[model samples]
Target chain A: MLEATIDASLLKDSIESLSVLVDEARVHISPEGIGVKAVDPANVAMVSFELQADAFDEYQAEESEIGLDLTRVLDILGVAEKTDKVKMKLEEDSRKLSISIGGISYTLTLLDPSTIRAEPRIPQLELPAEIVVNGKGFSRTIKAAEKISDHMSMGVEGETFFLEAEGDTDRMRQEMPRDELISITPGPARSLFSLDYLSDIAKPASKSNEVTLQIGNDFPIKINFEIAGGRGKVGYLLAPRIESE
Target chain B: MLEATIDASLLKDSIESLSVLVDEARVHISPEGIGVKAVDPANVAMVSFELQADAFDEYQAEESEIGLDLTRVLDILGVAEKTDKVKMKLEEDSRKLSISIGGISYTLTLLDPSTIRAEPRIPQLELPAEIVVNGKGFSRTIKAAEKISDHMSMGVEGETFFLEAEGDTDRMRQEMPRDELISITPGPARSLFSLDYLSDIAKPASKSNEVTLQIGNDFPIKINFEIAGGRGKVGYLLAPRIESE
Candidate 1:
């Protein structure tokens, strides 16, 4: 059972982060916080999200697991203003999520959690390079790369972090030296990633001031960023796409 | 031959106004100005647009009649900044329109004028009801109506001007009394129009302070708005849908 009120924008942000990877998710709600761990259908990406109880204006819940359709919730939130407080409660009888904004109420049927894909284990990784930069700047670079190619290479060589994409005739490269980045633990690390996953991953962090990236050669990258003024955290793990020489 | 240089935003606005109704149009470029008159495919609406030479930073023409595809021009302008100056010149050899904005050069092949639908005669009718209101307000009402229905009624009753849309189970109505309206010449007139046309025609005027609407019972409504400041004028005539009682 869960009944809480949070900023419409924060909830929308959280849902968007989850929707980018999985359409349906089994959300774990406890007095401590809320969590969603899901892997995309293609198994190329995994999303791990947690929002502390303090993130909500009013939060009270018993430990419960509910299956949610991210897209449906997102649509309801779409009509809400960023500053509006969205109250959500799980209806006991119908097992539906009731969302109330002003006078409007949206009831979403809880899906059967057993129908959702099995949760994936969080992979332990010790990436050699770490880069911290403005999330919006990184997102923009991803978009520019999208205009030219479908894949981009992320690497750190010495003190510079580089994002490069090559099309048949056009190539795009964005470099942020140590001075330009928030922080960089640079090394010789390179990994290619599909823009399809990279672009959507940027949605939740687009407004963030800083984003952390942990990368390794030909390995998955771990992206972590804070939400709701550090009251919430979202981590994305995207498997790298190998590039043929 | 035609040559002109204009602010990227101004040209984009003008094209967006006409593009809302017709895809291809015959653009008449004369020494004094540029004009486009065309009708939508369904013959439900007609758009007439004109920009005086004053609208351009530099203008020169030889009364050329060339066919243009608004969608293509709009695509090129999509990449330009608001302050960028777009220089357009008719290629002498290829008969293509060469659009140059900084380093980007887009050559759009001109369609044969004869291939486009014949220009329609501007219908002359005196509409009794005139209501001037914020274009954005009207546009927003149309968008909100679209969320519930495909058709809406526009009318003037006493000192109030109203737009009402009714769905099977929902209804939305927006009224602007004389005090709220910029100006009003109240008359007993009501007309039902398709949101498909009304929504798009409001694009160019969405940000404008004032939009002039002329309506008569079961007759075509004339929407007049200024674009590119006062240097350009756009008029749209939309046939009203007769309400089946």
Candidate 2:
């Protein structure tokens, strides 16, 4: 059994982030919070999201695993205004999820959790270099880089963190010294990543005030940020694409 | 010869309205104002746009017809900030039009006016039914109708003017009475128009505060609106698609 009410905009953004990798998700819900972890079909990226119970106006659950079609939920939520509050409920016997926003209720059938691929285990890594900055600044760089190439490199050198993308005709480099960013611990680490995945990951993170990045040489880089006024946290990991030179 | 300076945003919006119909245009420049009249490739819609001399900070020109690739200009103008002032100049000897906005100056090669289709004479239309309302409201109705069907009916009966679209399974309608509109001259006229043209025309008109529409039985309807602080006027004419039985 589960019932909850939350900001429509936050829920929409969360679902959009999940929808980036998978069409459906089996989210673990309990009295404490809701969490989801999944890897892309290509196995090049992993997405993890969590929202504390405090994120909702009112929450009630008994450690249930709810399977939902994120795309369908996103479509229903698209009609909601930013300030609208969405009330969601999962009955004990019904296979449908009832979502109500501003007098409009949508009954969406649930997906089969058994049909979904098993959740991915969170990998433990020791990344030495870290860089933190405003999400907008990072997202802007990603967008600008896309105009030049489909891949970019993020690296730390001395007291500066840099992102660069190069094409046959043009190259764009964005460098921010320690003083220009929220924080930076230079560790002489560098890795090349596909901009396609980074660009999508940056979209939701861009809405946040700060995005913390953890990087290492030729390893998966972690992009983490908070939403729902800090009541929720999202982390994205993308494996590097080593150059064939 | 011609040289003019205007608000970048005003120029952008005007170009966008033109782009909706055709990629190239032959604009007649005079001391009074600038005007362009062209029909879409499908021959279903014609657009006429003009901005008075007062719309620009500076204006000077001899009677001349200059051809331009509006799509290219729009792409260059995409870089301009709204408040930026754009200076434009054309020389009698050169086949290029130079537009300077902010610190960037773009020289665009012009298409030969002789290569473009001959200008069409403005048809002396006698539309009886007239309705004036918020452009945004009308555009919203058009967008909603698009979801239902590809064609819609517009007509006046009693005191209300109605727009309705019907799909295979769903239908949508918007109706407004004389008192609800800016003004309405009730006439027993009705016509069916291709939503494809009306929806595109409504996009730019929707930005205006008021749109004046004139309609007649099974004939073409005229859509008129003003922009750039009322310094410019736009008129769109769309031929009606006669309904069969």
Candidate 3:
């Protein structure tokens, strides 16, 4: 059982972070907070999201896991004003979620957790380099890269972090030194990633003030950021596309 | 020959005023200003547009008629910021229009005026009633009506101007008494129009401060609004859809 009241935008942004990777997600609700880990159908990208109980004005829950159809929730939230407070309550007997905003109440049928694909084990890797940059600038770089190629390379050299994309006839690149970035732990790190995943992930990251990136040679890159005014956290892992010489 | 430089937004908005009704149009350029009059393919609606010379920062031209593919111009303008200065010049010998924004230059081939449809003759309609209202409010009313039906009715009764739409199961109405409107010349006037035309026309109309509407029973409706800080004017005439009763 779960009951909570939170800002509409907070919940909407949290759901959007995970929805960028998967249509359906298994959400774990507890007295501490709400958590969701989902992988895209192609298994090329994964998203892990967590919202602390402090993010909500009121919160109460028993340890429980439920499946959610993110698209449907987004549709309902679309009608809510950003400043409005959203109230959500789960009916254990009916297996439905009751969401109310203003005077409108929407009853959404919940999906069964057992029917969803089992959550994958998150791999642990000690990536050698870490870079913390302004989310807006990083998002802009990814958007500009999209015009040049389907895939782009990110690397750290000395005190600078660089992102570059190359096409047959066009190229784009952006570099930020340690002085320009929020922070940097430069090392030997470079990897190529598909714009498809970076572009979707950028939408949510753009709203954050600081986004952290961990990279290693030819290894999956991890992106981490905070949402809901630093009360919530979101992380994304994208498999790199190895260049063919 | 013509050579002119103007704010990108002013030119874009003026062209948009006419493009909403037709994809291509015959433009008349003179030292006085620029003018265009065209009817949609179905000949159900017609648009008249004008941008005075004073609206441009630099203006020079000879009396000339050119066929413009509005889609192409809008595409080029899409890359320009609203504040950017757009320079346009006609090359009579090459039958092309040279448009420059910032450092980018695009030479667009002009269509042969004779190959395009002949300009339509705007019928002189003596509508008995006139209502002047806030463009934003009028635009909002039209948008709300769209949610109910494909057609909407406008009429004046005594001191109030009323706009309404009705569907099989839903209806919407917005009434502005003389006190609420900027001005009103009330009389026996009512007409029904298709939303397809009003919705498109509303795109540019919504930006104006005041919009004037003239109506007559079962007759075409005339809508007039200004652009470019009143330096430009646009008028539209749409045939009414007679109720099948």
DockQ in order: 0.04, 0.04, 0.04
Residues B1-245, candidate 3: write the lDDT tens digits. Answer: 89999999988888889889888888999999999888899989999888999999999999998989887678657756668898898996637787766544456678878777888889999999999988889889999999999999999988899998999999998888989999999889989999999999999998988999999898999999988788889999999999866
lDDT score of model 2?
0.86
lDDT of 3 by residue, A1-245 (tens): 89999999888888889889888888999999999888899999988889999999999998998889999999899999979999999898536999999779999998998888778777897999999988887777776667557999999988889887876543555677788889999889999999989999999999988999999999999999998788889999999999867
lDDT of 2 by residue, B63-102 (tens): 8887888888988988999799999999676488889999
- Write out fnat for all predictions, comma-separated: 0.00, 0.00, 0.00
Error of 3 at B147 (Å): 23
Q: Measured with DockQ on alpha carbons, how good is candidate 3?
A: 0.04
Ranking by lDDT: 3, 1, 2
Question: Could you give candidate 1's per-residue lDDT for residues A1-245 as a string of tens digits?
Answer: 88999989889988999999988999988998899999999999999999999999999888888888787677556656668898889877536777766434455668878888867899999999999989999999999999999999999988999999999999999888999999999876899999999999987778889999999899899999999899999999999999978
What TM value does chain B of candidate 1 have? 0.97
Which residue segments of model 1 deviate by more than 4 Å? A1-245, B92-94
Candidate 2 chain B — worst ten consecutive residues by lDDT sum? B166-175
For each predicted model, how many residue pairs clash, with residues at least 3 apart or on different chains?
0, 0, 0
Put down candidate 2 lDDT per residue, A53-87, tens digits, no spaces.
99999998878787777876786676567898999
